[model samples]
Target: MVSSDESLPQRLPPIDRALDRYPYCIVWTPIPVLTWIFPFIGHMGICMSNGVIRDFAGPYLVTEDNMAFGRPTRYLRLNPKNVDGGSSAWDEGVSKASVLYGTRMHNIFCDNCHSHVATALCNMHYENRTSWNMIILCFWMFVCGKYVNVCGFVKSWLPFLIFISIVVLMAVYF
Candidate 1:
């Protein structure tokens, strides 16, 4: 019998292929429409803005990737067997990174330390509070398959059209 795991990767839908090969085919892209329709998706941008909370989740994926490169030999692989009661082999590094992330943030910003919240050491903490920017960034990030803000350039009636359509649909259904 053919195993399910063996066929997983082969069935992965290639979204980027069309985007890179034919940029004009963007109208057919399901990604942007999904992002616009889903409000929770934008929450990621909102989440990254608060570094203090994010620190609780351990180093962001970028930081982990950079550190991984420096310790290439120490990297561990995921095992299907780890689904049981025992801890996985990779837990140690992840645990350490979590503590380090929280300590690093708290030591610098416990009290009313406005400066700490604004800038981490020298790097500026992302305070993605502006509603307009958040929506714009979320849209483009969704479209480009990466994080970036691009709503400033869009001031057309497209958003109005979407909102109107949603309201009308709700009215008709309800």
Candidate 2:
């Protein structure tokens, strides 16, 4: 038989172990200001201003580091067969790479586009460049874990983008 650890799925978190364990609470990501989902400014706090974790049950939010919150991703439930307790170093790395690649790809070509500027968001979901490498290791709720605003509150930041751009363009032209 394969060792439990070896059998583990490389990229997916052990939701079974999570559910088998403790009571989860909500906390904000350290760079909360960078993420619209997080209401509190920094560090995991008593309340998650708009944390995605604040909305769930089984996928309880567990505070890991001074700056991280943990929860399994919806990918586990949505695609259970893929959940194997195997080596995830490869998979996790790829996902991170995919995110970075997607962000870079999106930004390089679209940053100047109105929709992109209108959103007025940082390049990607992540911030705090220094802590980036450790972000995957940090036990934290997946952005799509318990909550998925899909731009619920963040969308509000859009209208102003158009307003600001128009003013800037006027200044440049006239």
Q: Go through the candidates in order and give each one's C-alpha lDDT.
A: 0.27, 0.28
lDDT of 2 by residue, 1-174 (tens): 899976986443333323322112222232323333333222222111111221111122222222232332121122223223212322232233323333432221222111221121112222212232223322333443332133523332344455567778999999
Top candidate when judged by lDDT against the true structure = 2
- The TM-score values for the models, in the order shown, are 0.19, 0.22
Per-residue lDDT of model 1, residues 1-174, tens digit only: 879975665231222321222111111111244325553232220111111111121222213112221111110112222222222212332334343444543221231111221222113112222122333433443455421113322322245468769889999999
Quality of model 1 by C-alpha lDDT: 0.27
Model 2 Cα shift for residue 3 (angstroms): 2.7
